[model samples]
Target: MATTSTQRFGIFAALALVMAATRVHLSLFHHDIWDASWGVFFLAGFWLRGTGRWAFPLLMAEAVLVDYVVITRMGISFWDHYCVSAGYWFLVAAYGALWIGGSWLAKHQRGIKLSTLGMAVAALLVSENACYVISNGSFYWLSAHVPAPKSFAAWFENLGDWYLPFLETTAVYVGLGGVLHVLAVQLARLSQHSGQTQH
Candidate 1:
């Protein structure tokens, strides 16, 4: 059997694609608090590491395509309902921040230790908070949805409602990704050991 680079990254790539698709579906149909796209973005950088430069942009492009399809084909009316304006473009920065945080954390990758888990959680929180601020702040300020008088207090209040859900969702998904990565590595090691014994 032969393995190309894509094949080598097959598991992570498949996971990323599934997560991305789920995100799109959730956005269009569910619109729930448990969004997975942000976590998947972070996982992409964590898993891809050196490949993140290209991977992050590719994922962002996927997001944009999904949003377009949702609004145009699915009759979601995201543009009409949500105040995107130029602020929507800020998602590039918001999501990029997540990618950078994940890439940085990957440099310190370790087993499922308390220290590693804490570090990952800390990084995730920072990235998630930054993403929320950028995304929410942009929408509040630039979205035509907001009336003439933009109330900073009102935005903060809305943020308070959303912030916890954002953190919880990201934490849950990232934790799951970590568990999956660890299990996959252990399974691969066990398989290799069995092959050695067979010979």
Candidate 2:
């Protein structure tokens, strides 16, 4: 759909604000829709499209700042609580994969086709699985909290246990987003046709 510069910026800004709120919720509540963190990334990428290049960094910084405040004010060690380390930086790559997948989808497809929808779902699965492996693998290998010497199968099993929640969250957000996008397009078309009839 064609959009004005102001419209594009406003949409992106709104997404950023919502994501910021979601981060705050996750930080304070510490549960109940933590998957919004993951959902927002792909949503931002899908909606922001070209602007996603910048939105991702901003959203990531927001997440990091929220974590910093939570750790500092709440009097908890992030490393101890989350088992983070230098490996935590791997999150960049993980999230980048998600962003890339969504951006690719945006560029390749305009209206949703079944084939494109399948591709989008596949992309999310691939990106989420990659994120799980990179983020969790790093934690398993590089974090001080993981007892020395872990088995691959054990790690694989652990990865499986957590995978469904992440997948479900991403699917829900993306699926809802797709539906909204379709509705918006249909409305725009209807409005445009009405304007043409008035002439």
Candidate 3:
């Protein structure tokens, strides 16, 4: 649960580069736009350090930057821009908790089972659906506007409309997240071994 400044900076810098590259190369970056997000980076930090506290600030930065870029540059309402961003924070939380990597997923002696992964994927899809339904309108939910769903009695009636995009985006992001987690661990292990050799 502790680390040196060097390790932290190395991980942060590596993740930032990966995120920027993924955003720019979505069409050919091993995934599509829907799956784009420094999701891999987020989860990597989470598992490597056993907490994604670093990712929170990054995600927040992403949200704020996106809101401004979209609002000021493209004439989008600033508030509306963040409404849809809400779901991404939820996603960060989800990935941050992925303490495993499949049959091989494990953290601090705790391995992740297939059951956990399934539940996580389902939970994420539902969370994103709710996010779109609330932020936009179960339709556009474009900006940050919390679409007042007249009554809780029928709040979920428009869920299906938001399912496709959410699933597509999260699946690819989460899959990449798994990769990031492994990469971070491997990098850390490699660093340790290299140090041992020098010693």
Question: For model 1, how does the per-residue alpha-carbon lDDT over 1-199 read when each residue is reduced to its tens digit?
Answer: 0124774368456756776677667766776445678888788777777776666777788888777776677665657646457799999988887887788788885756789878888888888889989988988888887787878898998899888888788888888988887887789889999999999
TM per model? 0.86, 0.88, 0.51
- lDDT for model 1 comes to 0.77
Model 1's TM-score against the true structure: 0.86
Range of the 10 consecutive residues with the lowest summed lDDT in candidate 3: 99-108
Candidates 2 and 3: which is better by TM-score? 2
165, model 1: CA deviation in Å? 1.4
Which residue segments of model 3 deviate by more than 4 Å? 1-4, 14-32, 38-45, 48-55, 80-149, 183-199
**Candidate 2's error at 138, in angstroms?**
1.8
> Residue 173's C-alpha lDDT in candidate 1?
83
Question: CA RMSD for every model?
Answer: 3.1, 2.1, 6.7
lDDT of each candidate versus the true structure:
0.77, 0.74, 0.49
Colliding pairs, model 2: none
Candidate 1, 116: how far from true, in Å?
0.8
**Shift of residue 191 alpha carbon in model 2, Å:** 1.3
